[model samples]
Target: AAPAAAAAAVHEVTCSAPVNIAVIKYWGKRDTALVLPTNSSLSVTLSQDHLRSTTTVRCVAADEAGDRLWLNGKEESIAASKRLRNVLADARRLRRAAEAADPALPALAELPLRICSVNNFPTAAGLASSASGFACLTYALHTLYSLPLSVSEASRLARVGSGSACRSLFGGFVAWEMGQRDDGADSMAVQVASETHWPDMEALILVVSDARKDTGSTEGMQQTVETSTLLRERIASVVPRRMRQMTAAIHARDFDSFAELTMADSNQFHAVCLDTYPPIFYMNDISRAIIRLVTAYNRLFIKPVAAADAAGDSAPAATSRGYRAAYTYDAGPNAVLYLPREHVTEVLGLVNHFFPPPAAADHAEYFGRAASAFLPAVDPAKVAALAAQIGFAPFPAGSLQRIISTHVGDGPRVLARGHVESVSLLSATGL
Candidate 1:
């Protein structure tokens, strides 16, 4: 047995990773266990300040016991979670090489890890929660052992946990290229641009439902692969072309092409879901309403944006005429909107108008289901007034629960490592 001092000695690091919403959705998997996507995908990583997973990993001397993970204060068995096991194993494997190269490396890899992860946004709400969750865990592990793995290699480790997670390891725009090799060696995420490159890119996350997804991404995609014949044609023909267009759009900073391709790909992905046998409907009534609203909003600025693009800063109408925004969704009902910073106020104002605040009598609903479900930063007084004027727009109060406003952001970041004592999630309950 280890000494009491050694038992209490836990080396830990807290890492935060941003959530990524795929514009070119990775809906089907070629290899389930290996997590190889059927087609390549692209995404914009949201700012960590708004939606992220802050995971703290503690490594101490231990027996052959398995690793453990706790999310949002609830302990989850690591053994039962294959995704988690793969993530930890990848990090430890990389650490082994590092230890061989440097003898001074700590023996943290030999010990079991205690991981505590918390997310500011709802879990499994079609917002790519797993993307940030596993990315943050792997990052904490990489930092704890001080491994020298490249960003791409580290992202590969996260891909084993969630396909979309690979992109979370990078910031701004990311592309998860589905490698052709069966070994999946070349299959990894690549950054399209840094957060600093496109300073105006913004994300408006609409929380349609905060509840756990009725059908998880893995399960839903698995079913679609088996039942939907359309999935094959999409991987073979549709995604390849879409990926090219999206890549070009990002490189050129062409918001018009970016918006068109993003919305088109989203619609096609959902269309594939419907073409599946027994059919899967990831988008509900609320999700459809959001699509209509976003389309209407974009109409105001599309012509202006196009004119501006054609003129390239010469057009006077370009500055104020168009709405530089688009919306996309994943395997759930939630909506992720992409827009420029100049229009956030107007768009948010419209959002408030549609989903107004509840009456004072419904305080519990706001603090309870509404609170846990959404995080719209609008003033309650304003919402109450909007509710009176709109008289219930399409759905009820909780239908559009939260609105997360963020933008193109960098990848996993190490926050305040020097002040470890303060950032510790374990706090007084020290490991």
Candidate 2:
């Protein structure tokens, strides 16, 4: 009998995608099925340290009945959802083209792929998991198949899974256009500025709240799409203007313009949330308190800077600059603060001060306090004391789980050569 063909060398490809927080948030979708956005949105891609997803896609020759995927070691049921399969199918179609002239294209079409993915940060703690997930998946597949698609084309495909996922396709400043097309072919992401373009910019992700959100973005957007008229005004007027301003801010490296647009867009998105008919609540007391702390800090320093400018006591040109800290939020309670890396330690120290972890004793007491009520219970007399002690405002002790710090980074990269590394293999016994 012919010796069994030497087991084909296992082929593997690894890719990574960074998490992105929207500055001009995409709340409602115009076409849910196509994952089209109601309005254009902008996002800043964080470094690998704060939030990211890495995926390895490998093809192996096997029975052609079905495909499989394993995420973080546990076998995932691809039948439960079509999202992963759709990505895999696209990859296989591209790989099949290479097989036309040669018989050894790794049999990608008949072979099942084993995919393993892991997120370095909290999955759904408002940290933009969908952004990283779809980005990693599409990137891994593209690498495995050697697809000849640009980042924009891949981003358009990623959007079918999640609206904001499209933005994760690039690093630094990115914008997802709400293209006026029926097929969604034109709706995709484009890079406004690469990370290298803004070398000093950094994003500090504050994990103010880690609890699973009550409303998934899908459900929340669907509700907003049907019930909110305010959404109409936002999509038609506010978002368009903000999109233009944000793009300009990124291009010119105007921190003042960037910060203003970022904060305003965030507030407006949350406002749209509150404007929903039944009222979807995303921010809690902790979120509001963080907002207040940031605003107060800006006001305190900004007023002084302005005064210094008027008195000619500071650098005239620099005095015209704005506050360094810019805040934005998504559908969850987490906050992304954009600042210069030179000030990262200082900003983080300030954030940790105002939002201290709740004392074990205070956790029960602060569970459901509203923004106004919670402020008084924190001991006004002790406010200064705590601020002095921590070097920033003191949050309810134990309120925060932990803080994740990251900066702007690249989109996806391929790490494996074809057919040389296998991610999985069936045993001879076929267990």
Candidate 3:
């Protein structure tokens, strides 16, 4: 009994995972039960410094209650979620296999587990919160049991919860390959580039609304599959070619090609959503306005390059005026604009001019990460000229709730066990 107690004491672990914005979005499913995708997808994992989901798992006494889970400070019935059960079962299976190979391993498999998870950002609001949530849960479980699964194998574990969650297992740019097998053994996420490979890649998440999405991803996907013919065209012809082009773009660090692919794919995915029976409208008027804003902003850089080419200027200077920003949307109204580090301040200033915050909003919480740098005011002349070019005026104040500035970042990380503030969820609600 004493040895068992000692072993249980050592079985706790805390881990956090980053939210990834899919540039080449995943829409429908091939296999609903296994959580397989209809097409391969790619995404950029956002830095956890600004957004993340943190989870802590620990073994409870055998005499205690059954396996349980608490999310965002509310206790939920763990047995009610098949996705949660599948992940827990897979982790135990791996732990048992490891223990059988090594007889010295502690016997912690039969003990009940208490898991508590929370996201720093909004949940179920079309912000890829599920990606971080499941990734953090699976990672914490793997660490708690000392499972011997590789990162790739760990990603497969995350996939059973949420399809995009698999991509969050790797850092930087990642691709979830839509494998050909029915068993889903080949369907896994692979890293295309490390976070440091493209240090200049940065993003701004303009959160239009934090309220829960009206239709969840699973239901929306099912509806699209049964009704939309465009999804068939996307799966058959569009995604595969784009996957190759996107992978190559990331490798070569070619922002022009990368931006083009990112924007086109986002548009098509939303188009497929609209083609669904009765249609699903994820983007509001605010979302459409932001899209136009990005289009005009990109065009502002085009004129200079066109003139440089007409003048037969050197290649170096002409290329410097290439596309500076790309915008993509997930299954929500929020917009994530990817840009070079140099352009963040200027573009944000434009956003400030157009989507000015409400008078009651706290100025301190308005911008995040690299965007916290004092914004150099954009020239009013430039803003007015660009607005005229797009044929749209500035939006009402508070059209956007907040903007989070982050960069490409690494995958899941285990937090130090002694960090009391970070681990407060475990005891705060008595999980």
Candidate 4:
């Protein structure tokens, strides 16, 4: 009884992980269970200051109830969840390895776990919340139990939860190498470069809609792999070449090459989706409008001033002239734009004027409209004068839900260390 009581004492850990945007998307898996991707991919980890998930892990005496989880205050069972089960098993294996190596380090070795995850962004808006969530969970486990594993090792554990989750374990530019092995032992994320490597890079997240995407990425990718022959072409021909090009562009800090590849790959990813037998449409009219607006903005500014007027009288002509920015979208409608820090304000002004956010306090709104005013990028002024002069592109209302502007950031971080009472999602007794 004494030993049980000692072991039952609640131990807690809190960690925060950033969301990652895949520049080279991972669409299909070679082995679904292991999340072994069909091809290698790369992503940029967003700052935890703006887009991230905070998770608290607590362990207590085992009960028949098994593992428990809470995502943004919603209770969920981990017992039947394949992703959670794999993540927990992986963590325990590492803990066991740690225990075997050291005689005095088995504090929370045989206890049930309760995990709580909360995201700063919309969980269902296709913002890579699962990637951040699983990354945070895996990181917290290692921190809590003092497991002897590197960040990459913990990333492999997160990969079991979601393939993209592996990329979140590294800061700034990261690549998930699709290692050629049946066991998937070699498949894991590696840092191409740290966040500081590209300090001038800026990202603006335009929340096109808070509505949940109809087809989740996992289901959509499965359908693509099974039905879309284009996916095979992508895996065999397109992605490999793009992956090489994207990596070199990042290394060289060539924004033009990087931006061009980013946009092209995103378009090709959607193209393959359409190629699917029962087509999956992730982007709607609003998304298409944003795409057009970006291209127009680039042309209007990049081309000589006379060329812009030669095209038509209605271009969004601004004095700031250059194709210094780029845009990319995931499986969802929301768009993430990359640019130099200096250009964020100019571009953001255009985004707010064109695709305005819907009016509502809204449910689970990430940053919501409240986050707009605080954008370090720019003031979301209706830009009444700028719009009238440059010609406002009136997009449909409610198409946009919110906006969050942030730069690339470091990977996962420990916010609170050692017995943090406030951060724990589990109850006082580890219920």
Candidate 5:
């Protein structure tokens, strides 16, 4: 829309990444400051449709005192913690060196980075915001700095922001190694398998509740670490066995084995959460209802299979022929269900039946107070029109907002076609 001369001078680079929810959860921390885990954890990266963060890092030399960050087009104050700043500084330094090494190199660090990020899904709803945020940040910084950091190295940097962020650096199935070193240099993530490797895998993300939790993971983990003796058994005994079994299941393409292990591990993680001193409550009524539905569905399907196999006089086939579904939950009310791709529509239908939209009268009754206060002088017809514009639909008379469905997907990637700009003095001089 502007002059060609103004447009040609600016260069932009955009990067995007998807969020992942851990099945074998990373609950405790060995080094809180470094965000190191006490034990290894595994997660599946979901498709960008269900949840994702898109970050654009454009460099410009402006007279600003410090870098700025924006989320969904609104300016946000950077977190007070210096971890992110340190990572950004390191990337900028590398960029500067790259510029110096080549006279033709464009200066990228001197330009102020206008970072605009948006989470397609809810933030702080226990849906892994750290996973997407840190992954997107790392990916953007690496590109902006012109650094040769591999995905592993970028993951290590992201780990400093949040323990699970490391896993988000990779696609599909990923494992975060809990390094022995206290410094956390060895703590990083490695991909187990690409989404292509397991073509039939599908994830159904049920958004049971979007309300922000009162206690953050940091505080909750600290409490559990200090008090829960059951957690000692979980970390020392239970998780290691489950981790090994899960790895084997993924490799062998054993859905039955995988489903059983995934659900059990999730339950154990929540069990440890409840055993904490004063008991931190992560799951709610809606979450339990989802669990009940999944369990009943599994039992209903498995019963028929068991009965059919048992009736046969010949030796029963060990492997499952029909589609299998498994449900796993994280720290919040959201449920991540893994199933065969063939059953996706069936799953969606079931989800929709459980959580329908609110009715028009119910919506009016619920929002009547706010509507009355805001539009006291407006016409009744106009008020109704305004309410419709706000996207207030009658959901099934319940608390749940909606379901977010996604499947396993790829990690962070660069978008070269977008606008780009140099951040330093050298680039401005066209050196």
Candidate 6:
């Protein structure tokens, strides 16, 4: 075993965190500076295998130049970012507190930090890039400084950077509690269930466009807060009730309830955006087309099942229930569909049939690397049948940029030194 003092001398750490897509969307903030939310929100953390942000933090010699940050291998000025500064200060405070109790620990809080972060997926494209980025950064800071912050405490530090980032600290189902405290001390995320709680849940991300969204989420939501009357009613009445029901549905693994709530919240979130003064439009025509396609697919796939199959019955009557997939959108045109693992191939096939990529687009390019093998060969006969059933034509090629096939996944994790060596920007850039 290593000596106890050696741990305090560590100067660098690397960590990776997964992106989380909210089923019950979070919009508007009570405190912009604190990144506190007006309503509690729930999200499913996506697999890091498909989408993740990796950050490496190193304590460097004190410099009058101050700390430096590089995002996706590009240098970015961190001095103007108050949120990033707050996260660093809070982590340093925690480290100082730990050293106060243990005199042997080094005084590392005063050292400057060099942070390098990169995302496998597109940044600022409504994929919760900031959430994963900040989560990874905060987690790495705690590791580098050898702080004793619990997951909940670490989540609060992450929240100061991005509200959704707090939820990225936990695996599977997570809920961000909008606390009433004025100082924002109580506003933190709680785990609803672990990643293994509901193993069959899977997600399909339909990337309508990877280009940067026309309107950023923070600016757009603030506009909605100031002008949209529907948002007021939603915050007052709809969210509280839906939060309770959504929690129940997740615990029960009831797909019908979960699907309905997911779609409803997403629809209302976008509607609130539209109601904003001057009207903010996040969903493009392609986004609307995906919504209609998912709705029709869910409706048209109702195959009657014998009651005897569901429950032993003497006179086994028939009952129909069809909810193969549920779709939700953040403040962008991309659609994330949640469904059972058994239904992944079918739902993906339906998407590929209606929204075929260009003939020239590589299979790995259209469907993410992890999902390439799962992409089923298109069947023209089945496509024709589905087209006739739903009365919707196939979209033009290239309407969708890609499909990310992932599932519920664990939270942030410290990366091994060997793994960090391969992807660390510090090593790659020789900085």
User: Could you tell me the lDDT of residue 295 within candidate 6?
Assistant: 81
lDDT by residue (1-431, candidate 4, tens digit) is 37786565557888999999999999988899988999899999998888889998887655634677888888887866898899899888778777888867654566778788999767888899999999999899989988777888778899999999999999999999988998887889999999999999988887777778999888889889999988998999788877777787788777766776788888989998999879999888777877876766666455454443322222233344466678888988888888888777677667755765555635236344235443443333434443444454567656676667788999999877655677665667754
lDDT of 6 by residue, 78-144 (tens): 8888999999999988888888888877767888878889999889878999999999998888778
- Per-residue alpha-carbon lDDT of model 2 for 351-415, expressed as tens digits? 64576655553443332111122222334443464354434445566777665656788877665
Q: Model 3, poorest ten-residue lDDT window?
A: 309-318
Q: Kindly indicate the candidate among 2 and 6 with the higher lDDT.
A: 6
Q: By TM-score, highest first, what's the ranking?
A: 3, 6, 4, 1, 2, 5
Model 6: lDDT of residue 7: 43
Off by over 4 Å in 6: 1-8, 63-65, 302-320, 369-391, 417-424, 428-430
Error of 6 at 349 (Å): 1.4
TM-scores for all predictions = 0.84, 0.82, 0.92, 0.86, 0.79, 0.90
Q: Which is superior by TM-score, 1 or 5? A: 1
* Candidate number with the higher lDDT (1 or 5): 1
Which residue pairs overlap in candidate 3's backbone? Answer: none
**lDDT tens readout by residue for model 3, 1-431:** 47766643546778999999999999999899898899999999999998899998877767876898889988999879998899889888888888889878777788788888999988987889889999998888878887887887788889999999999998999999989999898999999999998999999999999999987888998899999999999999889878887887788787876887899999999999999997998999898988898898888776453432322211323154478899998888999999999988898889988998877877778775644577888888889888997787778898889888889999999984522555645763336
Among residues 3 or more apart in sequence or in different chains, the pairs in candidate 6 whose N, CA or C atoms overlap within 3 Å are none
Q: For model 1, how does the per-residue alpha-carbon lDDT over 306-372 read when each residue is reduced to its tens digit?
A: 4324313231232344456788988888888898777777667666557654433354443332234
Clashes within 3 Å, all models in order: 3, 13, 0, 0, 18, 0
lDDT of 1: 0.77
Estimate candidate 6's alpha-carbon lDDT, on a 0 to 1 scale: 0.84
Q: Where does candidate 5 stray beyond 4 Å?
A: 1-11, 93-111, 303-318, 321-323, 354-356, 360-396, 417-431
Candidate 3 segments exceeding 4 Å error: 1-8, 303-321, 417-424, 428-430
* Candidate 1 residue-wise lDDT at 326: 87
Best by TM-score: 3
